[model samples]
Target chain A: MKYLLFLGCVIPYRISSYEISARKVLEKLSIELVEMPEFNCCGLPLDPVNHELMLTLATRNLCLAEQKGLDIMTLCPGCAGTLRKVNKALREDKKLKELVNGFMQEIDLEFRGGIVKVKHLVQVLAEDVGFKRMREAIQNPLTGLKVAEHNGCHVLRPAKYVGFDDPENPVILKKLIELTGALCLDYMYETECCGAPIIGVNDKIPLHLTGEKLRNVKAVGAQALITVCPFCHMMFDLNQPRIERVLSEKFGVPVLHYTQLLGLAMGFSPDELGLEQLRVKASKILNLN
Target chain B: MKNHDSTKPNSDGGQANDRKKEFGRTEHKIVLKASDLDPKFKYKISKIPGAERIMLCFQCGTCTADCPIAKFSETYRPRKLMRMTQLGMKDRVLSSDVIWLCAACFTCIDHCPQGVEIANVLRALRNLAAKEGLMPVVFKELVSNIRNTGYAYRIPELRLKRRAEKELPPLPKANLEDISKLFNLTHLSKTLEKEERQDA
Candidate 1:
């Protein structure tokens, strides 16, 4: 139950609650988490601009995990997707592995493929820590709270590489949410992109996309939006005010990391899960005045 | 015939007739020449990572139909971009802003009937565009941000202070020397350096 926790760039610096709550929940589940301080960006930002460079960067982290002889448990879906994609590419293509190793040699690290596995937090919870075990751990079931799950794009997409769940119709996140006794509301554009990818390049499009999803979630009478990835959390939680201003609509939906919800269900206080750090207040959903 | 006549007054032909009366000739014309095609463009795109399947697209338009960005945007069309790449319309594909407009959400990639990997192809086109100095200024700023710090957005002082107030562990500092070395070896730094020179 041990994993090399890969909290990619955003979670460490921007969205600390995701890491904080995930660690709290994983520790409670008896999952040992380790840190590799040398890990770099998951290479997602560079992927579109330079394919080989992105592979090399992602492989560098995989090699770090290989050195520790542990599978990676990633917090961000982008890191999960990039690392899994590179791991698959290197495993299938010996020549490409050697090519990447040639670059790694300069950095004094080598990636011997198949040494470790990369699992997203959702996979770690849904698969490694089963629902029955999680349900038994719940102390305060969120009986009537309506929450919408935003799985984000990379978590279940490019299915050949990231095979955690069905790409088109994912149920892992929903199943996990239901385990908390919360109503996982189904809404239009539930699986749509949160526009985090292009947020750096163009603000308007991503804002519009996030606004659309928020509008849909609000329309469905969900009090909160549940998220797993940090970037999606940023779009829905951190940039919520800006998104509202851009769309000229008020969506008071609170965005909570899945870990926060699980933490609350396990009887941990909102303070323990860093709930106050969120832009939108989760007080209403958590029943904490 | 009566309906056609009713629409004729509102059509371009009617406008052309008005222009002809005022200026002796029509002033606007669009022509596509066979010589505009560059046969090497597809080969060039195939060399990009994740775009090996660029030629597999059969123009099903599934990418466009499934695209969330295309739904709101009048100009952003993944299907059209795929066709342009397949037809070797190099300049059009590289120079147009639509290539940069793709959100890279991979919605089209997952839903493509032909499995074209349309989003990756758009990414390849973006890479080629950036290499050719066709990338937008804002993206270059992002590249420069990564070049300066290992992260895309700089960690603000207030966020660090807030993390402390929340009793969270401080973020570990990135090893910029290693990042810089990797950037140097990969020539990603070189790309940004070229951009700086262009600005100067």
Candidate 2:
């Protein structure tokens, strides 16, 4: 299956490993990913400040994917949520579609709305790749590793729009984790927000929230935390040291993008999946040490 | 105006002075004025996206109770904001720093029995706050970052060298012309321009 990969701003610049491992894993599964250089920010950052403008910007990206007659697949939950919401809004409301198209006229783009679907990578893996296929692709099963799943808010929130799984009780990510032969350890705050959305506004609150989740995961004895969104990965992975320092606790839980975990099980080395780039080392979990 | 005093005499016929002494406060009365309410504020908020249900809230504290941020910070309460918006206390709702504290997690919206989109209502309030130049400095910096570069955060040089070392493909540049045009067409540019002029 061919899809347009929308690498929203964060992955390309900050979290290249998510992109690298995702590309390699999808390639192994024979899913062709076409890169769209014209894609801009998914308009999430603008949502609170300017609702109409945010819709217009998200619609522009949707229109770009429509031109290719391919579905849009995103690595970030924020991008997936924004694009999915706008796509649903424009498709369901004619007046709103007209209003957004008016703004799109300036950019020489018009969204046909329903022509394309925006799928988060988690959705693509759970549904398109299928558990049977993923299991078959695993060359080295992770037998004893324990993982905590961090399903960030946007990917499964406002249940009506996202509709991927149960918002309160999501299991797609957990099931994907199990496919790699790792134990998806159940923990408190599994469905809580990573507080990434408000990180820019207030450092203290988001850090507290992230620290709380980290503490819970660490308490459960999970070797690592698995995530799908780049922003969540940032909070759990990049800021892990800072989070530990702030909370005065040592949580040696390595954070891995789902693709990275899947890549390891699929016979890809730690270096190949960019595990070395992570701040919290995955040596123990990956058996690298 | 009506004064509802909790320090008033109880059904046992105790004196107001006795109740005041019991409570140890002289200003325990809530003063409600008809003129203090902004009847148009609800309609104003309804105009914002995802906040059409602002008036549908029945003062149910589900949003507040389900809020993760509220669990930690006493000042951040979604249910109270909804009530303030409904009462047309525009200045109180928009000026308070609590409005900026919402994490936009949507847990409140997901669990709201009344189906009030609490998070989106907060977003609408934030937009109104920004228009009135009440946004925090960090949020303003993020807006400027997007306005100029089409991304929230700029990629640093060290990260650029690391990307090169990893042999990752070069990051794509944003179409700033279209981004700027959209910002200009919307009220964001005007609000930000006003903020800039005020700063200058």
Candidate 3:
């Protein structure tokens, strides 16, 4: 099936490998990712002030996908929640839908109800690329790798809207991690916020909180962490050094986007999955020889 | 007291006698000034959906008392910012670095007796400060970099190369035109310029 890939801001520049890995793995599952040209921020940031604006922005992007007659697939949980929220709201509220549709019409876009289905990468794999197909695709099973899952805050919270999973104790990432034949270890701070919000305001708190999480990941005897959210990956993988410096702690843990781990488990090589870009080197965890 | 010796000069090009006229200097006292918000300035707290309840804040100190980071760092105080915003002390409310200090953990917002969205307001104020160029130089530079480069997270090429020496893939760049466009669409820069012009 064809879907529009919304890379958002975090995935490409800071955590480019995530996009690469996600593409590689999804391609393996027989899914085609048509890149959207000129897609801007989903305006989730605007949700605080103008919820309508947030919906308007999301509608703009969704309408772009609707133009292509394709479904929407997002790697970022924030984008997913924002898109799903807008999609559901517009589909349900006819007046609100009319207003947003009018706004879209001004920009030459239309939001026909249910024109697109926004699916997180994890859901795509488990549902579209089912466990049976995943099993068939695995060439080199991650034999003894102990993995911990950090599902990210946006994936769960504000549950009344997103409704992705049990907001308090999410197991989707854990289930995805186990599909790779890796031992999944339970760890505290699994569902905790990685402090992505405060990164703009105060870098110290996010650094400290993420550091505590990394320490917990290590304490759980996990070889690496599997995450679905790019923001979480940016905080856990890209900003790991900053966190280490601030906390005066050492947790040389490697973080993998769920797709990257799935790609690795499915017999994809390190280079193919683009595992080289991570700040926390993956060789220590991956059998990349 | 008058100086008995005037043979040496002081650092200020005066007499050294004035610096230490006598061994006992109890008569001299250091004076400290108590500062208050600028009298002419007032901050109007813009309405944020979830944070609208922030208006009910009565300076109860509950937010300050329940804050986690507040225990260690005094830079952030939700109660104080809420009070300041309610009083229309715009400059003090928006200019203070305290607003940017929120971790956005929702602890304060969740536990607030008045259902105040302390974290959300802090986010808005910080966004305002960023738009106004009131943010710290480093943060402003980072935001500028993100605007131009499309990525907020930084990884030096040298470090990426060094890390890649272990057979890791080169760091991929995230697409950031989306963010730049968002900032532009919000007229964030224009609003900031207007505020700066007004302040000047």
Q: Each candidate's fnat, in order?
A: 0.42, 0.52, 0.15
For residues B51-119, could you state the per-residue lDDT of candidate 2 as single tens digits?
989989998698888777766564676887899899998876776666767777789888988778889
Better of 1 and 3 by lDDT: 1
**Which residue pairs collide, candidate 1?**
none
Supply DockQ values for each candidate.
0.28, 0.31, 0.11
Candidates 2 and 3 compared by DockQ, better number: 2
State which candidate has the highest lDDT: 2
Candidate 3: interface RMSD equals 9.8
Candidate 1 lDDT at A227 equals: 95
Candidate with top TM-score is: 2
Cα lDDT of all candidates, in order?
A: 0.80, 0.81, 0.66
Runs of candidate 3 exceeding 4 Å displacement = A45-56, A92-106, A110-113, B1-48, B51-95, B102-190, B196-200
Q: What is the lDDT of residue A14 in candidate 2?
A: 82
